[model samples]
Target: MDGYVMRLNQFISHNAKYSRREADILIEQGRVNIEKTKANTKSVLLEGQRVFIDGKYVKPKDEELYTVIVYHKPKGELVSKKDDRGRRVVYDTLGGKYMHFVPIGRLDFASEGVLLLTDNKKVAQSLMESDLEREYIIKINGKITEEMIRAMNEGIHIENASTGAHQKSKIYSMTFAPFIRYEIGKNDIHFSKLKVTIMEGKNRELRRFFAHFKADVMDLRRIRYGWINLNALPVGKIRFLNKDEYKQLHQFMGKIGKIDSFISKNNI
Candidate 1:
């Protein structure tokens, strides 16, 4: 094959408005077609083959001229398209143009700050999985003790690191790398403030790390992702990546072909 070849479900998940699981369901229901022929869940798709779902033509993903945006996610907003419990989702505020964009990772419901979104799935996946620096400001209950500093310097590896994890999270064991950098802003007995930088975006990493120290994070806000900074962006607002930012992004993405090897060597 000289061009794109992928499973029918994967292609729908990437280019259509459905999750992989949802795509599988649609295929089982015989709602998807390729060149007017009914398709199965395990069907292989090739370049130039037309794909449709429920009689709606699926647009191919754009390889050129895509849009990226920075959203100042506010607290209490879920980083999802729809929440089953009627909780507010980012799309409720970012409706219309950005409705279909893929969010680059997530900021949990109670935590908020710089959230990135893009119309291109490849760009979103690259940025989400890349070993890029993420900076956050956190306020945790209790003092920033020597043990906390030592753990930040040495990192943590635990088999049951689920204290700060969501109840539904099945990921029990996790590997946290040494923080790239950390600085304490306050050291009060009741509460402390600190800024931390790390390359790993594992699930609720900060919450879990501080939880191991018996400190609960009260406030967490992300301020930066790699070269992209929140700067003066107000809460619940969205802005396009400036030309220079886009240039820097593409430059970073250009080197991601061997990203697994890169992450392995870098301890992200």
Candidate 2:
């Protein structure tokens, strides 16, 4: 029964859209099976054992086959499945079709825009970990300072980027890369509006960046991620990547050594 052995949760996670953590919850709830018997938390799988979740048999899928959805997330919604504080989450608005999709990177509860969610774990993980540019339209409470422009152009290292961060954030320090580019919309003593592009997605990065200058990020919205744009997508709606978008993604992935890394990670 054992050419190679694996944990029940790992099997379900690799075979389905659920994460390893979500797979564990499914097993604990008695929703998974191995070799036609209900599985528990400690259940293990042999190389050839069959697995079923919710009455459907599943197996490892390595075809590079998957789907991506671009969602125009709205502010005030958490990126989580459910919130501990009972706040609305993206899933509540994302609806049933994308119940298990993994978000590429988070936009935080207060920010919104071209959020990418995919059914493929590898795609989601790869994109999130990549250094692709993220473009944003943001408004800060104070005028754009010359010092800020210098910092953006030359990049800056902060010992403790302390303010404007989420209360629960444990990130005390960060090194920000020079912005790819920036364009000012309006700047005055009242507030400054600008569009900036950068390739880092550290925790509450925009907020923290402005905070370092004693400015508050008044309104922050992401306009683009890599080659995908928010375009005319209304808030709280989702769309599939068009043919051109998929082609761009595929080409990018191919050059990014995606195939070899994915093969090695899955031990295929």
lDDT of each: 0.88, 0.85
Lowest lDDT 10-residue stretch of candidate 2 = 10-19
Q: Tens digits of per-residue lDDT for model 2 on 167-234?
A: 88787888888899999999999999999999976698878888899889988999899999999999
Sliding window of 10 residues with minimal summed lDDT for model 1: 252-261
lDDT of 1: 0.88
lDDT of 1 at 190: 99
Runs with alpha carbons beyond 4 Å of true place in candidate 1: 1-4, 18-31, 53-56, 257-268
Error of 1 at 150 (Å): 0.8
**Residue pairs in collision within model 1:** none
| lDDT of candidate 1 over 1-268, digit per residue (tens) | 5666888887887776676777889999988899978899779888899998889899887676678899999999999767889999998899766666889999999999999998787788888888899999999999999988988999878788899998899988988899999999999999999999999666999999899889999999999998999999999999999989989987876777467678889999
What candidate 2 gets wrong by more than 4 Å, as runs, is 1-7, 10-22, 36-38, 42-47, 59-62, 258-268
